[model samples]
Target: MRNYVGAIAAVCLAACGEPGGTDVSSAPGALELTREADGAASGAWGQGEARVRFASRRVESGVYRIEVRQNGMSLTGLVDAEQGVSSLDGFAEDNGQDTQMLDGDRELLAGLYAALGAELPAGSALAPELKYLRRAVGLWAEHPPAVELQRTVMGEQGRGYTMLCGYAKCNGKFTGSCGTTFNWYSYAKHDCQHGGFDLAANQQIAQLGDHATCDGDELYMSGGKWVCGEPDHQSRPKVQGNCFGRCGPGCGGDTQYTVDATNHDGCVRNGHALTSAYCNDQFTAASDDELYAPDCY
Candidate 1:
């Protein structure tokens, strides 16, 4: 699955010495590999046509544990160069895309691939698309809904209604990933004064990883904020970068709320309030007068 915020970058460079430079041929060390298949166990070195070659130089003078096998059959065995001994382990099978060792053994898989001078199988059928969608759903669950809640509350003079909403940000574990966006709207009637509100907000929390990009009508609503323009990918924070760093200054925990009449022509004269808060956090309550509007005919 595409990781959200915690996806680590490729570490092959740091772990493996400059690619294509590490020589395994001249290593002076003993390797012992075993393979099991078809109700029989065998050594890994000097087996049938499918065998792994052992090569090591300037290493420990003791024996090393290794095993290789495929389809319940022995393919190659470990080698003791100093002792001049070789054995077989299991057989290899061609599974179309790449060679696969039936047993649940990676060492055997690597050995067989090395012997054949080919890459190992990709392993498993969890495609990239399914993995990412699952992650996006999980992120949405943690944060508060971006839509404003309109409720009726009892007051001294009579019953009053209020509208509330805010912005929320969800961090994806993987880097360079993108997510889907959504929009919402609502209307209501109370005490003879027909009331309605409309706003637009964009949600990119789902695609924070997988390096996905989106652009279309650009109409979206989230946390009471409206976004109509396209986001600049080049300047935006990447999923692989520091999550916390992008949380504030970069992503800017800001939510914009605006009140509009049922006509939807313009804001309710004075209905825009700007607030600052972290993504996924709740919005503070506003006075009834600040959000409530009387009948407008």
Candidate 2:
């Protein structure tokens, strides 16, 4: 999905001294990327082909965690337009192998950045990274990378009720990687004290808004504070980033109430319920005089 924020700058990396690595920029050809109407992008840089896909979640009103999946690597690029600062948490291969690109994997980092930068939409949020990555490579002059992005209109946000969403471990194990869509939200109430789930991981948050509805089978609420629901796991979008950071300031220690997808009775309580209708009630009741009530169907 297109990121929620706009114009957050990119990170700077030192020159690459790593001798042996996949050198995408060093290949011979112009770098070109075309964003499809569906928002996914693909292109070729030198000898290899690269593709870009995105999943995003709002960190706050203006901050976003935009995961850029290029080829087989997932990059965590934090874009805080409100703050005007951006950072990449790091890169992880599809196999869950972490690569410390900042720690000396310069060649591969620059190559990945080049592909990612080139594949973004003409005015997309990652555009600034292209400039910074060029400077970081130091060899930009020798093999000056040219970025070509097709003029694709980014997607627009939907007009629906916004709700807080997150996922954590279940029964001492995470259902999926933080990046996996199927494992995005925990359908069970897995908390730090009761399940020994890491507090930092549980705090990584996302939102179900823009007219999206939760799965009817896994509906829940936290005493009218916020309602919990499940999105389609297979097709729900994915975001790249470590689940270590909390969603927003002061969201820590908030009690989470989730209906166990496997067994609903284990976590449902007085205020929480399993049906979508009850979820809507909790949502409507939580609003201020229903001023911003979600038009639940």
Candidate lDDT scores, in order, read 0.21, 0.29
| Residue-level lDDT tens digits of model 2 in 48-145 | 34333333444455544444444454445444534434444333554455443232233443454444434442224432223223222211111111
Candidate 1 per-residue C-alpha lDDT over 1-297 given as tens digits, one digit per residue, 9 for 90 to 100: 000111211111112121122233322222232222321212222233333332221112422222223333322222232332222122223321223222233333333323221211112232222111111111111212232211121111133222222111223222223134321223210111122221222112212211222242222233455444332221121111211111111111111122211111011101211121222122112122112222111
Model 1 residue 142 distance off true place after TM-score fit, in angstroms = 22
CA RMSD (A), model 1: 25.5
- As a whole number from 0 to 100, the lDDT of residue 138 in candidate 2 is 18
Model 2: how far residue 129 lies from native, Å: 9.0
Instruction: Candidate 1: list runs displaced more than 4 Å.
Output: 1-271, 275-283, 286-297
lDDT of 2 at 293: 18
TM-scores for all candidates? 0.14, 0.24
Scored by lDDT, model 2 comes in at: 0.29
